[model samples]
Target chain A: MNGWLLAATVELGGAGAAALWGTATGPLPRRVMAQNLATSAVCPALLLLAQGYGRPSYVDLALLMALLGPVGTLVFARLLADELLDDRPRAWTLTWAAAGLSAAVVVAVCVATGPSRAMVKLLLIGALLIGGNVIASRALAGGFRGVRGA
Target chain B: MADAVIVVALLLVAASATAAVAQREPARQALVLSVLGVVLAVLFTVLQAPDVGLSQLAVGSALTPLLIMLSVRKVRRQARAKDRAR
Candidate 1:
């Protein structure tokens, strides 16, 4: 309806399509990476949706997603450790790109929110989104030794 | 139009749900299912039901995959143990 909602729609359609495709048809490592990207991709759109709808409560959804998305990926990284051991899947380019998108969306949302507690919350979600994304990517890539053979 | 966002979200949910069902392997299906969960939550949110979306995200994103993967790991380990015993 509005610009913010439209951006959210585009973000959801593009990134969501890529995530679905990547998860549906791919090697295990790539599939796991796509799963991780799903969280990062959706969190930003949730923020935009909250902004578009003018309901700050919806931000809670994005906040919860920022926390849990990587946890899900870590579960896969740990459980599928042996299967992933040999290849050690890596997708740094996609990881960074998603991080960049999260940053842009967060910054845009923050400015739109101005200097308020809500802005701080948005900043927190952005940090979690980017940080969790990198950490999840590393885990998927076998960056943590303990995770393997455990 | 606002309806476009809803339509996109609905289409995504349908595609991911289909993908989840189409995956033959448990691990692969679990991965697609997780994606499906995220997509569904987005749809719920777009439809102005954040409450459902919130619960959906909580269960879909991490919990369902965790349960499925744990069972898969146990089943695989059991089969490997049986093979070694023989």
Candidate 2:
């Protein structure tokens, strides 16, 4: 787990540097690359933290991350699409709000629960969170052609 | 024996991950990630998680990289179209 953690930390550091460079250059590909690297680095770090401290409850971090990863990528893609399709702030704003709220809720739940039953609950809750998102996305897509398929 | 395999696997995984990001070609990047997945799967096997190893092999090593490659191809096609339009 430490090994995984260390690797993730190193990758995160690399990604951070890349992000800085990307920001400076303002290249869309560079920005996408940085975001992808950062998100990928996160999952392993969460896994490591969960294992290292014996706080299996940190699995919630992983669970929340599973939800966030694709969403973050899509959000970035959506933002990119805005630049190409039409410059619009509304899509980005909504994605940011949704991502932020879910992340906050996951962190709050993780902090509130103790290690044992908390871990199990975290897994269950995290599954439900992701499950709900998938269902909602599917429903929205089916309901409206404007929603755009995920 | 197991410990040795793990150390080697870890090294390979690290190398693969680095190569994935470092490579200029998208196809090479995908290939490197696939290699990393395979190395990690072996490490998982050594750790006695055959289930995980199987999933890694199925999803990470095989499915994911394939999908990534396809996405890359699509992106490349789009870029070519954009260039042509310009």
Candidate 3:
């Protein structure tokens, strides 16, 4: 029990470290970014591999996060870079529209499947985590921009 | 396990902070931070917190460097702009 709490706390620290590190660095070299992004995406599968011994609840949650994390990072990078849009605004907009449409379809599928309560909760939590991150990041960027504008 | 992890966490955090200050180049700083992150992840794994460790390894050691590189590019750009202005 205490181990769990400690793990959770350390996890928070890890996440905070990542966020701070990322914010400090900005976007990395393209190859490095792509490699990191690929590794980030693969982390979930790696975690799933651990479940061969026993099915841990957190493993499921991690898998969900793994699915979303890289995608979110890539999307956020694209949005922040804004060059894609800058170069071809219509194409960028259409791509985002399609991505959003696909996401909606995935969500509909999950709802239709009537997943287990734990899975549903995990999904909701994952969404909240992603949404919260987006909001917090935007707020932070906005604050920085304001400071710079001043 | 818990106590050990806590100790390691404190140490890693200290290392990270120290590295951030001690490192001069942006690339070197990124590397230090990645090392610190790996240490933290290992600490978590030792504590039977594979999930947390995995996430840390992913975000900290991997994604974080990429982000830093981007910022480095921006800073270089600004520096060039300043040089041009001069």
Candidate 4:
């Protein structure tokens, strides 16, 4: 296996283990935070795997993940708002860390792929991943309180 | 070894699935289930089937959790309303 595959394997294994453990045994807010982290953690691994496998088409998986993962978190945040309002899960460090990881992965992949349509696609996925992650985290922290009962 | 990634993905899927089953609360189970979906998608991709992974991500990550959570909310709301009526 090459460096890309090795990196992907390590990141996936480490992040996946932590996410599983956190989500499985935790309070409501912590579990929600872990669920959010899972999306961010897995998206970069997916990108790395796409690069490692030498299949540009596989990047679509990452794109879908970047788009949907946060939606899942938002669903939990909204649905579990009652339970979470008091605690307000705010893992800004973890959120920024995952965002930074996605940014780093996307930049590395773009550099490897050079300027092209694929680079643009990679950038889009990165933006969506980070932006959605932040938004979902905000919602989890009860940033959008107006929508709580609605 | 290239197979290392696959092994890791498989282990993740196994662990997450077990976690999903072990969770007692419906809400917590939904959270675990969402993570399970993402891990399973990664497993599918590692197995050289991005097509399946794509669909799994689409369904497992967001849709399944939304459905489960909505149902849980609805059930709880109805129960609460019934208690209030008495």
TM-score of 2: 0.36
Position A78, candidate 4: lDDT: 78
TM-score of each: 0.98, 0.36, 0.36, 0.98
Interface RMSD of each: 0.6, 14.0, 9.2, 0.6
DockQ for all candidate structures vs. native: 0.94, 0.03, 0.11, 0.95
Q: Write the per-residue lDDT of candidate 4 for residues A116-140, one digit (tens) a residue.
A: 9999999999999999999999998
Off by over 4 Å in 2: A1-150
DockQ-based CAPRI category assigned to the predicted complex of candidate 3: incorrect
DockQ of 3: 0.11
Q: Candidate 4 on B1-86: residue-level lDDT in tens?
A: 79999999998999899989998999999999999999999999999988998899999999999999999999999999999999
Against the unseen true structure, what C-alpha lDDT does each candidate score?
A: 0.92, 0.47, 0.46, 0.92
| Model 2 C-alpha lDDT per residue in residues A40-126, reported as the tens digit of each score | 333433444344445554455455445544454444344344332432212233333334444544454456455666656665645
lDDT of 3 by residue, A23-115 (tens): 335433322232223223223222322232244454543444444444444433343443322322112232233234323433543454467
What C-alpha lDDT, on a 0 to 100 scale, does residue B66 get in candidate 2?
Answer: 55
Per-residue lDDT of B33 in model 3? 63
Where model 1 places Cα greater than 4 Å from the true spot, the runs are A147-149
Model 1 iRMS (Å) reads 0.6
Task: Tell me the tens digit of each residue's lDDT in model 1 across B2-52.
Answer: 899999999999999888888899999999999998889989998889999
